[model samples]
Target: MMESAFTRPVARPLVVFDGDCAFCTASIDRIRDRIRPDVDFAPWQRLDLTALGLTEEQVENAVQWIGSDGGRASGARAGAMLLRRAARPWRLLGTVMLIPPFSWLAAVVYCLIAHNRHRLPGGTLACAFPGPNRV
Candidate 1:
């Protein structure tokens, strides 16, 4: 099948997320609208995971970052990668996040947030989960 507007490869980095979650959607919107990073974001539901070298289980859990070179990062590392591409302050923080204790802390924090996102502001009932959210 021919690639439509949504399925083609991107020259820029791509951020894969779960569109079914309101919190996730809000977060991405805020960042894209306000921060204006040089990245492309797509809800995994509308894109082909296999073409993007992603898995349903991968995107269903946390946000994902796919660099133009096909490198991938998820969760906090993905966030860090995004911030690193942003202007000034965020870039600084992203760089720091790649460091020792900060990276570890960011990872832990990301997991916590990802699991509890359904309870966060802007979250919806469809995003709810009872047990562990990770796969």
Candidate 2:
């Protein structure tokens, strides 16, 4: 039987992201202004990865969601959680996204974007894979 590891309880959901990536920072900025959730944003560089039960590889690959209940989700799931935090139609979209086939598709789309994020708006070669290790 497999045992779980993440157990730290958060008072609110926290988002762990790659701070070194311009694209990531810009995306977060847009989300913050638009969604304005009570969620906490912590760049992996400034956070304690061990305390969060995270690794360099995980943060490097995708954004992560750490819920108040200690539930953890990554990539598209993480994005979905943030969308749910948004207002109205975006929240509704988030709800629909988490369902079955849509969830599967969301994951695929997330991976594609994440992998090529360096090529996205505001991104640079600095956002490339095996990106800056400031932590």
Candidate 3:
């Protein structure tokens, strides 16, 4: 039987991402170690995607954030959401990232980074897999 989202106890919001991608894992680790944001980070591999209203295809694409209240954000917005849960400077940046020009730039930057993540530091061949970008 699959566990539903309601059955899960979330002390904070959740950040879901592709586990198969080394870059993704490394990035999450950095966030955990450095940012220490008040959010739970999980690889899509270990969780029942359906329970989170997510799919392999969806998570395979870009980062996702699900709030304790079930609010969601994807891609750069997801990054913003995560930052908002973090400490001062980062939180402030996240807020600014949500504004018009900044949000637009973030989206573009995220797309470029996503497309070339395999070549980025900490990335691997696994990060190069072709997939749709839902964010």
Cα RMSD for candidates in order: 3.3, 5.8, 3.7
Prediction 3 global C-alpha lDDT: 0.86
TM-score of each: 0.88, 0.86, 0.89
Task: Give the top-scoring candidate (TM-score).
Answer: 3
lDDT of 2 by residue, 1-135 (tens): 111333445767888889999999999998889888668787788777887789988988889998887888999999889788778888988888899899999999988888898999999887878847655
| Model 1: lDDT to the true structure | 0.85
> What RMSD does model 3 have?
3.7
Let me know the TM-score candidate 1 reaches against the reference structure.
0.88
lDDT of 1 by residue, 45-64 (tens): 88767777788778887899
lDDT (CA) per prediction: 0.85, 0.83, 0.86
